[model samples]
Target: MNNDILDKITFDTGGLVPAIAQQHDTGEVLMMAWMNRDAVLETLEKGQVCYWSRSRGKLWRKGESSGHVQRLVNFRIDCDGDTLLLLVDQTGVACHTGRHNCFFQSVRDGEVEIISEVEISPDEMYGNKSGGK
Candidate 1:
């Protein structure tokens, strides 16, 4: 892990960059989240995915509570150096809603449709935690 490369990333005014997580083998995009420098460094050092939660205002280790961990396979930066792509080996569900991926909605013909079914229930995933609506 090169600190020089990580330092070159141009974060937004809020000191955050968008990170898109994808399944390495399947190339399926799992989720998109925000990351700060600390999160990036932690992910690289720990071999697990970490994100900066705007709502929580802190570092969020993926699957800290749930068991659906993401093992880092590869990390990439976009051409602008403002965004990241993380190829990971996902363990269980990725979406907080108990879906495989966060992008489960499809917009077609002026209608918003759900493209995927929930693999696990929110109650089962987070217990009493309020899964984002």
Candidate 2:
């Protein structure tokens, strides 16, 4: 619970650090996000995932509207000391597209094929929080 470890982390020029979220039990990578100092503190203290949205330019709580909250199981730091690995217990689909993970498509040979389909629609997952067009 010491701040020394967190203090050593190096942030990018934008004052944001990359945070990788992984499924704790399965060891599957869920997503990667940016976190500012406050986001980090908020996550640790709350045991909920938080990120600094680059596009939105604000602090976003994981599953704030989608109800796909990622509960923090364990938090880790890489050897290089620039990134964080958050082991999470995901509530629902991690991707906005309603897939289990963000990486649904893989490069097979030279063609990119759709290996999975959206489990739910954007409206169902994100609701009005996304402000659809």
- lDDT score at residue 17, model 2, on the 0-100 scale: 91
lDDT of 2 at 34: 91
Once superposed on the true structure, which residue ranges of model 1 sit more than 4 Å away at CA? none
Candidate 2 structure lDDT: 0.84
TM-score of each: 0.95, 0.91
In the range 1-133, model 1's lDDT, one tens digit per residue, is 7888887798999999999999999999999999999999999899999999899899989988887899999989999999999999999999999999999999999999999999998888777787632
Give the worst 10-residue stretch by lDDT in candidate 2: 124-133
| Cα lDDT tens digits for candidate 2, 1-133 | 5688678788888898998899999999988889998888889999998889888888989988787899999988888879999999999888877888888888999999888788888878767455211
For model 2, what is the error of residue 6's alpha carbon versus the real structure, in angstroms, after optimal superposition? 2.4
- Stretches of candidate 2 off by over 4 Å are 128-133
**lDDT of all predictions:** 0.91, 0.84
Residue-level error in angstroms, candidate 2, position 73: 0.7
Residue pairs of candidate 1 with colliding backbone atoms: none
RMSD of each: 1.5, 2.2
